[model samples]
Target: MAVGALAGALALAGCGGGNDAGTSAGGAGAAAGGAGSTGAVAVKNVDGVGMALVDSAGKTLYFTDQDTAGSIKCTAACLGFWFPASGNGVAGGAVAGLSTVHRPDNGQDQLTFEGKPLYTFKLDTGPGQHEGQNAQDSFGGTTFTWHAATTSAAAPTTTEAPPANTGGGYGY
Candidate 1:
């Protein structure tokens, strides 16, 4: 009886080893595809506008138009469309006044300037395309828009001018 019990315990230990092997294999697969690995953002000075963050292949990342710091108001579905570019671990260097902001939700380091969150558009599949820019109407009830960063000293400005009077005579 003692020998039988010892043999059964050894069998159980072997079964546990098989489970561990399965887990390790699963982890290896995930790491291979860069699924959990974070890619770093490369920030550079483009012209004189400000600092812009790009991917490893030099793709531009979009910034929120709002002028705030450390807080990103985008949540839920908005996050689904515009995903933040993440760094592997280290904070990247600053450029054109923009700095790195760590996002707690995804453990990704996002580029921020004047305290706004940065993102890349899902629709933009190529480099140098600022598809996220001026996308204010995409999300209903959300007042978010994209702003392209430039190294230029003068920021792009848009002013609402007064409506012009139509000179047509009425009530004749």
Candidate 2:
């Protein structure tokens, strides 16, 4: 198997390793994707990421492979750059796959999509910046690659190779 395929397995293998599963993502966050919202969260077309979910301030939401259905590998120093989305931030519309889960380390609730926890990047300071895209970070001992949260329930099937790590990975 390819390295990507192998790592994918390890990611899934680490599932249910976080706090007890809160409401299933399917139950709490599951729904058809939409472009309506009056507060909290809404859909926006992001550069490079296309139609993705954004926070009230328009910060892009992201997830990581290091996290599983009920697991969150991003903590500690990892949070220095990747901030968790507030669980109280409702999609406020018909947006699908949006929900919240309680953080095991901190009893506070965090938002999630498709069962994976959501986060906002501190590096994305300017409008339309997604420096977090594919940025690798290690939490504890697990490594993660960040990606924007999309409104669609189904991810695009791709065969392209991941970009080269010429810039080096996140060491924090």
Candidate 3:
């Protein structure tokens, strides 16, 4: 029941207005595409989860069970919690399976891992936080399960931190 309550509260927060951050797909995309920005995808060692996919800011990225290849089902209110990884920046390092999917709604390209749409959880406080792992919730009438992005069938360890974009706005 507590899980339900938390999901409800988060959903409500997603519905509220005045988000200066702007819920538009373009808000986070700009920072993701700025000049001198390095590749957006990287593999890092997360606290309990070992190795997982992280964005330019070293924040954990996730894949949803409800989304399919080349398409994203999360939109409108759903984008509130699950911010799509912008399909900008070069694929630095040797991170494999990095690609982008064309979002039909706003024409914003969303980053993909192994053909799966990628997203970051809004509630995660910082890097190494896998708060959205295995989370089950429904938003905009869609039910989905979220999981951390892993390098392969098994998680690998990497000492390097993801590239940093100091001017970017999508951290924490």
Candidate 4:
């Protein structure tokens, strides 16, 4: 009887692992406050690197750091602005070289790139709204900037000289 009960409990747990409430066990569905769902977002090659963004079911309100390498320095008051996405606490599926790591300060798993930590901006509100891209801010004379993904294909360069200006020049 004891063994039978244990098997039933395990089955129940596995069945609950796909809904919003079951997300704690690696389920799907979004969280409150317009955050992303625990479901794995489809990753595609954006330029040369692998990238994933919030889907239609999920709101892109949080932001992650694109420059930090394997270390999440955001915590305490920082979490209030940029909340981390939860659920099985891992970035699931095959996303090229993307992976997850634990934030020692909060015990939350964070997505990493080449072992470096990544983050989202607190101000982003939706998908395709990449206002945080290439953004630069200065703190104590140190400049922090978002990194842009590079394309794997080579772009064409202009080789011809520019035509002469047709408009009149203005001078003081």
Pick the TM-score winner.
Answer: 3
Ten residues in a row with the worst lDDT in model 3?
A: 29-38
When 3 and 4 are scored with TM-score, the better candidate is 3
TM-score of each: 0.51, 0.63, 0.69, 0.45
Best-first order by TM-score: 3, 2, 1, 4
Best candidate according to lDDT: 3
Candidate 1: stretches off by over 4 Å: 1-52, 88-94, 104-108, 138-140, 153-172
lDDT of 2 at 39: 36
Model 1: worst 10 consecutive residues (lDDT sum): 28-37
User: Cα lDDT of all candidates, in order?
Assistant: 0.49, 0.63, 0.70, 0.40
Clashes of 2: 0
Residue 127, model 2, lDDT: 51
User: Model 2: per-residue lDDT, tens digit, 1-172?
Assistant: 3435534543443342323245323222122221211238777777667777788878788899888657777764455456777745555566667777888766657877889888777657755566676666544467788888876634533566977777666732
Error of 1 at 4 (Å): 77
Per-residue error for 153 in candidate 1, Å, reads: 7.2
- Candidate no. 2 TM-score: 0.63
Q: What's the distance in Å from true for residue 10, model 2?
A: 22
lDDT of 4 by residue, 92-138 (tens): 44445445677676565755544545444444564444344444443
